[model samples]
Each structure stands twice: as C-alpha cells, then as structure tokens.
Target: MPIFHKISLRPEVENYLKQSFMNEEVVSASSKQEAERRFEALLIHLAHPPSFTTVRVNTHLASVEHVRGLLLNELEKQFSGSSVPVLQHPALPDVLLIPVTGPRRNIEKQQCEVIVGAQCGNAVLRGAHVYVPGIVSASKFMKAGDVISVYSDIKGKCKKGAKEFDGTKVFLGNGVSELSRKDIFNGIPDLKGIGIRMTEPIYLSPSFDNVLPSYLFLQNLPSAVVAHVLNPQPGEKILDLCAAPGGKTTHIAALMQDQGEVIALDKILNKVEKLKQNASLLGLHSIRAFCFDATKAVKLDMIDGTEGTPPFLPESFDRILLDAPCSGMGQRPNMACTWTLKEVTSYQPLQRKLLNVAVQLLKPGGVLVYSTCTVTLAENEEQVAWALKTFPCLQLQPQEPQIGGEGMVGAGLSPEQLKQLQRFDPSVVPLQDMDTDCLGDAKREDMIWLANKDCIGFFIAKFLKCKSTEEKVSRK
Candidate 1:
C-alpha cells in the first residue's frame, strides 16, 4: 500500500516533468495515457525508498562474503530476533543487498505526537533514527523516554518547539523520545545525537550507523554500478570530476586494487575534506582529493616543476568519471521538492561545462563515463546527444553489466544509441512487497531483479575517445 501521497512539487516543475513524459517519442511508443500513468507512478515511488538497502563491500580490506557475515550478525542484533536475510548480488560481486520491509500499516498511532523536519522524515523511512537536530516540535509535556508517534512536517508548516501541530504531517511510526523539549530547544552548542529511538518504524530497514564502517560502504545501487562502468584499471591515472564525499572515488581506487592514482576534484573546500575523510576511512590511499573547479582544470602552459594535482596537461588521464552535479530529481524517499523551474533546469550548462573538461582531460583512447542522478532529458539524454555531435572523436560504448533500462526517448538518439546508455527508471518497475516467507534460490533471484530495477532514478552514458588520425600519423 502506498502510505504517502505523491511527492509534492511546484506547479511549474510538475508541468515541466509532465511534458518530458508526454514527449512525442514517448507518446508514439506508448500512448499518452500510459505515459501519464508512469509519471504518476514515478511520483509515488519517489516518496518511498528503494525496496532494498544496498552496500558495497571494500574488497581491498575484506572479501564480500566476510563483510556479508559481519553485516548479517550486526543486522540480527539490530532486528532483535526478527530474521532478516542478507543476499549477495549475483552480477555485482562486491555488492550486498538487504530487503527493506515496509509501510507496515498495522502500527498504531499514539496520542502524543512528535514532528520532525522533512529531510529527517525521509531518512527515517530509509531506516534512519531521528537525530536531535531534525526534531521540529514535541508535545508540551514530552520528556525523555516517552513513547510518541512521529510525523513528518512535509509542507514545513510545523512550528519549531510548538506544543501541538495540526498542519499537514505524515505519520512515520512511533519512537521513544531520547530528549525533552527543553533539551532540544535549549541554546546549547552542538547537540548532536539521536533524539528518538524508533522502536516500531513504519519501514523496517537496518540502520547502518557505524556498523562495519571499514568493510561496508552504504551506497545506492546505481552509484556502485557507475564505478564498475568506468572500469578503472590498476596503474592507470583516473580523474573524478565533482567527486565530493568520494564514494565513487574510493570505489574506483578499490576496484583498481589501490594501485592507481585517482585525482578527485570538488569546488568546495569542506566537501573536499569530506572526500579525503571517506578515502581515509575506506583505507584507499590511491585517491588524492583537491578543492579545485573541474571546468578550469586544464592547464595550457606547463610549469617547470609541478606535482600531480589539477591544472593538468591535456589528455593526462587514462579514464574520467564525470558524475555531474544535477538537480537530483531521481533521489528516492523524497516527500516534497519546493524548487522553482529555474532551479530545476539550471544544471544543463554546468554539466556541459564539466563534460567538456572531461573530454579534454581524457586520453585519446581512454574511457569517460558521464552519469547523473537525474531523470530529466535536458540533463541526461539530451546532453549525450549534444556530446556525440560536439566531440567527433568520442563514440558511445556499451556498458558492461547493462542492468538498467535503455536511455529515455525524445533525445534524438537512435535505437542503437539508446541501447548503449543505461537509465534506471523506477516507474517502469512496479514496487514489490518483500516476500519474507520465501528464502530459497527463487527469492534470491527475485531480490536481485528488484534491486536492479526498483532503485533510484539514474542515468549513465559511457564514451570512448578514439585516437585522431592526425595523432596516429604523428606517432608513425
């Protein structure tokens, strides 16, 4: 049962999305009515998280089986006797999938209510405990250890520190409060900790708060797929543009057996620090994070003596992963998006700028993978179409696993071209209820299929730069 309403979007933004679904290519393939239905389904699914929680094992430190065992034991303790199954991905060796059981309608609501911010509520749906900073309001007399029903202020109507909230709120099961109203609202410096311990969450997924921190990385399924598609090799020089938080950067290094040099760049200083921190945590010494703009990363003049950092010479990298910053429309478990159409459509230029840099920095025969966690044609397929025309030496390459659906239509890409790209469309795959009773090989197969299709909306396009004839002649 779909517990929440379709994700609330601005009127203009909704119309923009509607046109993308009802585009001529889509309408010709499937009727307008069917297109509308899928778009509606997408909205509903966005409000919910993926059917399974995906984790990427750090194969450099431990084997996938070893990490799976550790995760199984940890989840067993977390669930408290509820038998949870942890299955390894059939296609992806370094990935593990755990089914997320959900929208449990049986949990009774309580009289005393606690309201949390929208972002925190979304995290709760994905098995995150309510932290102190996310709490918005509590009952007047609510104290520590009080069992209260938790609700999300989806529309941002709940006043902070209010005694009661009657505005639009979605119930997110019940939890025992870990702090009183005074403790949360008190003018304290950095009150960072769990505010509510969810005893009966609506969605029963394991909370990975420091569980197997070194061996397992809590990543979305599509994200793990991106690193594999790049297929970084040991001893190769790779560049990761917009690689903040460094999930893919570390994964790429790990895949290379920590022998390659991965130069990761992000514009923000704090985000670069976070990238470095994640690299340190995962024990990936090959990754070097820098606070530099990827667009201006190319160096026209050579300095007498320079280190291996950005402002690199042209064609310096063997491979590049341009996971461009996007509008993030494809992220799941989102209850509401209050962005204007301008903000929603602002990523295309930036993505193109990054893509140009990626092409310039990649070696003639190197591979470049462009990806985005967005579902828009302008930022995804359209960009691919533009790239193919702008760069004559680049050719679309087939993805290795090809687990996701083909690229979306209406981008002027042919049938063969679309097949080369991968788009993880959540709407096309209906959300299935977890079959806990079935624990056989059949169940494992079903879980793997669901894990691939029912993931966050994502887009990936792989391109290989062909050596120019002039360059070949010069070499000869």
Candidate 2:
C-alpha cells in the first residue's frame, strides 16, 4: 500500500502529466489504466519521503567506519537512547546510510494546532523540527511550553497568524511549543527561534538540527550518488553548471581532496556566493565560483586560449556536471503543486541551452553528466533521446557505480541504452523496515549498499565526447 494519499496538481498540469504517461509508447506497451496507475503512483510517491536518509562522511578528514560510529552514537543520543543502526554503503566508500523509521501511523493528533508552511512541513517529514521562521500560524492562546499538534498547510492556503486553518492540511505530528502565539507573531516584529520540538513525526528520521555540523552532511541518497558518479580526480578542471547552494559542488571539491580547480557557476551572484560559503564551511578551497549565466559561457574571442575565465573558449573543462534546473516534480513530501501545464513543461528548452554550453566546454574524451531531480519524461529520458540524436559524437557512457535503476521505458531508447542511464524511480521499491539481522555481516552491508539505489526521483545520463567527430559533426 502507498504511504501517501493523492497528491494535488493543478487541473491543467494533471492533464499534461496524464497525456505524457498515456503517450504513444506508454499506451502501446501498457493499457491506459496501467499508465494512469503509474502516473498516480508518481504523484503519491512524490508527496512521501524516501525510506532512508544518506549522509556523506568527510572521509578525507576521517575514516568512514569512524564517522559511522560517531553518527550511530549521535543518533542514539538524538532518539533518547534508541540504538538506530547506521550501516556502511558497500559500493560507495564515503557514504553512510541510516534507515528512516516510519510513517509512524499511530501518532495521535492533539487539539492545540501549530501550522507550518509547505517547505517546513516537507522538512519535518524528512526529520526536522519546526523552526519559528517556517511557522505559518498557531492556535490562539498557544503559549510557550504548551503541547501543540503540528500540521502542514500543504496547499499553501493557510494565512499566517491565523488561530486555525480549515483549508487542506496534513498532520505532521505533535510537538511542544517553544514559542507562544504572541512571541511568534508579535515578539519584537522579527524574532526568530525554535517554534516546536517534535516528539513524534509521521516518518521518523533523525532531525539533524545542529547535531553534527562539521562532521556529517545530510544529503538525499541520489544527490550523494551524483558526486560519486562524477568521480572527481585530485587535480582536474571541473564545472558544475547551475550549482546553487553548492551541495554537489562541495561534495565534488571534497572528492577532489581539495587539490583541483572546481569552477562553480550559477546565474545568481548570491547563489554563487553561497557555493563559496559552503566550500568554506566544509574546509574545501579548490572551488572557484562564478556568477555567470551558463548559456553564455562559451566565447568566440577566447579561441586564442589566453582568454581564461568567465567566457572561456570551447573545450575548457575536463569534466562538466550540468545538474540542470528542472520542474522539481521529484521533491518529496510535496502535497500540492499549483503549476499550470505550460509552467511544468517549460524547463526543457532551458535545460537544452545549458546542455549545449556544457557540451561545448568539455574537452574531448571528457565526461559530461546531465542530471535532474524531476521525473518528467521531457526533462529526463526525452532529453537523453534528444541528446543522442542531436549530438552524434556524444556517446552514452556507462556510469561507474550504477546504483539507481535503469531509465524509464519510452523515449525510443534501447534496453542497453536505458540500462546505461540511471533513474531513481520512487515507486520501484516500497518503503519497509528492514530486518537488519536477517543478513550476515557481508549481506547486511550489501543490502544497505543497494539501499542507495532506492532514492528520490532523479535521472543521470553520462556522455563522453569522442575525438573521431568534429564539433560540427558533434552538433549535427
């Protein structure tokens, strides 16, 4: 049975998604009912959190086992002495996976209500306590230290500072109010503090609210997989296009052992600065961030090879990772998406423009990875199909530790071609508590290793530009 109820999409967007699922190829292989079923599964799964939370340990500073022990101890402490097992990922050496326990169905709702914004609600589902800033409203007479039931206004219809919300809402769990209604709404106008301490949540993952800051990085399983797939060498020129807040950028720098030049680019200056700050926090200095539009990264005047920076000539980077901005339909615990059909389908052109620039900037025999967090066929499989036809020189290269499932069926891709592509399908495996002791030491490790494959809805397609073809032929 699915953990989440039906996810809400705008009527037009729902129609668009239905059409995509019921397209020629999909309808040919499966009945329209089957296609609609899968599409509905996609929607429901998107609103529920993944089963496990992955944390990438700073292996350059400490060993994976050492970090794993520290994290396990930390989890036990966080959960009030409940010994939650932290297992090592067998395939990837630098990763540690912790199984998130629950959809904890038995958590009872209370009368004192505290409402939070959608994003905040999503965080709580993924194991985060409600912060003051994310609070949309609280019950009247809700004072500090009062026990309050927390709910997420998933549809974004809740007016802030309201005593109660009758609109669409989902109960996250119960928590003790840290701030009174007056403190949250009227305290000095802009006061910020912890709003609620969550005692029970639907999906019980460890809330790493300042738990292990410098040592552990709480990242989604698929996002962690991306950095490893890029396989950053110690000294190389790498480009992370559309890198904002620099999660992958920092991971890439860490993987490089802080020895290489990692050029991080995002259109927004503030976002680029955030990339720099994340690098600084992680003690990684190999990254050189730039606030430049990726589509304009190539320059004809720079063919002299001396025009180095911002608008560099073609073949400038050794490896290019385009984690393109997409429709973001894959994000978990998202109860509602108010986007129109056109708005949801508008990212393909932008992604293609970014891909064109990324391909041009990659050196021959260099690897270029195109990834998106969304599960849209147009953004993912369709993009790969388009890339192969448009760029003949760009041959699909098999991923190094292909942890995710094969790409979805459709887009005229062959079985072998689809196998080379990685897609983290949310519905492939259902979330269930694992019997950790059922497997021996080696098998337990292997099961957790495969757990990396079960992740958020994501897609990664790697390509290598062959030298046999010219730029013109490649673009043909």
Give the per-residue Cα lDDT of candidate 2 at 44: 76
Error of 2 at 238 (Å): 0.8
What does candidate 2's lDDT look like per residue over 1-476, in tens digits? 65567678888887777776678877778888877777777787788877678888866567788878888888878889976777777677777877777676777788899989988888898888888889998898999998888988878899988998999888888999888899899886666667899888777888777766666778777888888888889889999988898888888888998898998889998888877876776778788888998899987663455444687777878899999999988877677787888888999999999988888888888889899998888999999999888888799989978888888777889989999999887766554543334322335655574465456888899999886334464687
Cα error, candidate 1, residue 446 (Å): 1.1
lDDT, candidate 1, 345-419, per-residue tens: 999999999988888888889999999998898999999999999999899999988899999999999999999
Model 1 weakest lDDT span, ten residues long:
434-443
